[model samples]
Target: MCNARGDEAQAVARLGFLEWAFTEPGQVTAETVKDALRHPATKAPGSAAARAFVDYLRQAVTPLSAGRARRGRARALH
Candidate 1:
C-alpha cells in the first residue's frame, strides 16, 4: 500500500540498493556490489530490471578505476 504497485518492502529495499550505488560504503570495491547482489531483497520479484542496472554500474566503474590506476602508474614514472 505504500505505492501504486504495492510490494512496498521490496521497493524500499531496491531504493536502498540504488542509494548504495552512490554512497561511501557502496563505492568500496567489487565485493560491495557482490554483497548487494547476494542480499535477499535483491532477489525479490521486481529484480528483473536491477540486473542490467547492476551490470552497468559494475562495468561503469571498471574503466574509471583503471584510468586512475593508470595515471597513478604514470605519475610514478616521473
Candidate 2:
C-alpha cells in the first residue's frame, strides 16, 4: 500500500542522512555518531546497511596511538 511505501521511503532517507553524518568530512563527532547509532531511526529494520557503515566508522576512528608510535620509531631510524 501507499503507506507502506511511504514508510520505506522515509526509512531510506533517514539511513542516507545517517550515512552522511557518519562518513562526510567533519560532519559529526564520534560521540554524535554513537548516539545516532542508538537512535530509533537508525535502528529500523531496514537500516542494517547504514548501521554497518556507522560501525565501520566507529572502528576506523579508534585511537591510533600504537600506529603513531611505530611511525615515530621509523622516523627516528631515518
Ten-residue region with minimum lDDT total, candidate 1: 1-10
State in Å the error of residue 27, model 2.
4.6
Give the RMSD in angstroms, all C-alphas superposed, for model 2. 8.2
Candidate 2 lDDT (Cα, 0 to 1): 0.60
| Candidate 1 segments whose C-alpha is farther than 4 A from its true place | 1-19, 47-51, 54-78
User: Which stretches in model 2 have alpha-carbon errors above 4 Å?
Assistant: 1-19, 22-27, 41-48, 67-72, 75-78
State TM-scores per candidate. 0.35, 0.38
Residue pairs clashing in model 2 are none
Tens digits of per-residue lDDT, candidate 1, 1-78, equal 133233544465467556766675524577666665666644643443454445544553564548888889999998
Question: Best candidate per lDDT, number?
Answer: 2
